[model samples]
Target: MTSTKTMLTLAVATAAIVAAAPAAAQVSGIATAAPDSAILSAKAFGAANTQIATTYKAQLDQATAKQTALTTQIRTILDTNKDGQISQEEYQASQVATNPLSGRVKAAETAGQPAIDQLRAPAVKAQAYAIEQVALKYDAALQAVVRAKNVNIVLSPNAIQYAPPTVDITKDVIAELDRQTPSVPIAAPANWQPSQDTVTLLQQYRQAVYMQEMRRAQGAQAGPAPAAGTTPPATAPRAPTGR
Candidate 1:
């Protein structure tokens, strides 16, 4: 199991590395989008998440029902004192005997969790991979928008002070992302390893990317039009520059 986890981790690390390659400053910024670029809202991704949530809710219901049944059985066993009330001592003692039954139920549930997880794994994988692909697609679209605008820097919509709605290509990129595939490919073996630095780098990169997405979503929720000519609020101070 540990080996499997390690392998899966490595595969994710690899994908993340590949994704980050294009972000290097050296990568050519020669993209182009129409002058009237669409603004892509982060909320658009929510459209694809309903199915995933439904799947998880069903699994949780099953788990909860199983737990409820086990609780009833345990209660019945502890009601042994016949006083219509389970004494604390009785409850504690009965717990040991009832524990096996509970354990059995739990073990079964625990065992079943993996199966349920396995069943859902592919969908989850696909969703994540698809999200990444969408992000990449957005990146490309944004680059084009910048090039067409004749801008050297493609500032995040939130970061830019007062760009015209027409100048913000966020919407167009999001639409394209939605139309594109949103499934993660599951090639990770149930074995794979790389250097620790690689893993750390991947984790950091993923966190940063997630933060960026979150900020974009927050900005989208906070307004209709950005305040004209106002830069993004100052970000929290960063750690001292690294080598």
Candidate 2:
């Protein structure tokens, strides 16, 4: 009787295994197709972005050149001796001198600022638009790649501590983006202005760059700071203390 019951249990187990085989195969196939923790980086896509950036930079370069010319002209007028350089004395004299040159320099700076601001406004808007367009294209391409590869998870390269090169899909995404969006329009529409958020961010970025440049220039002109623990020499030992 025991041998007959053991045979019955073996038959039931074999039937169960046969029934689960197809389901196990399906699960294995899905696992093979979908990968977890795939990484993508937007930094890999820059060809189209670089073109837009270059356009904006050209505008800034033109404005900078004009400003430099105006500054050079003012400096020439201050160098009354035709020495091609303005001494400290010359700089001080130019500030208080009765000559019309000082007045012209001051007027040029005051008038030029408005023109510079006008030029900068459109350039800033164009840059913001270009960045937005590029970002949209990148996101679309990233989504397409994710779908095509059946990726279960995505992570930015910056956020990952360690990832094998094989798991990075940045190049694949960039290729897809290049095919979808080969170029980005950098021109700003008439009277175009960035959104308040973008404007605030741009203003902050400009301020930071300005402050950094100012600090760099000041440091260059002022020499390095003294080392720590530095002290002035004693003055003849103070002639010794009184008894």
Weakest 10 consecutive residues, lDDT, candidate 2?
Answer: 232-241
Alpha carbon lDDT at 175, candidate 2 = 68
lDDT of 2 by residue, 137-177 (tens): 55567667878877644544433334456667767766676
Where is model 2 more than 4 Å wrong at Cα?
Answer: 1-61, 67-115, 190-243
* Candidate 2 accuracy as lDDT: 0.47
The segments of candidate 1 whose C-alpha lies over 4 angstroms from its true place after superposition are 1-60, 63-126, 147-151, 179-243
lDDT of each: 0.39, 0.47
On lDDT, the leading prediction is 2
For candidate 1, what's the RMSD?
A: 17.0
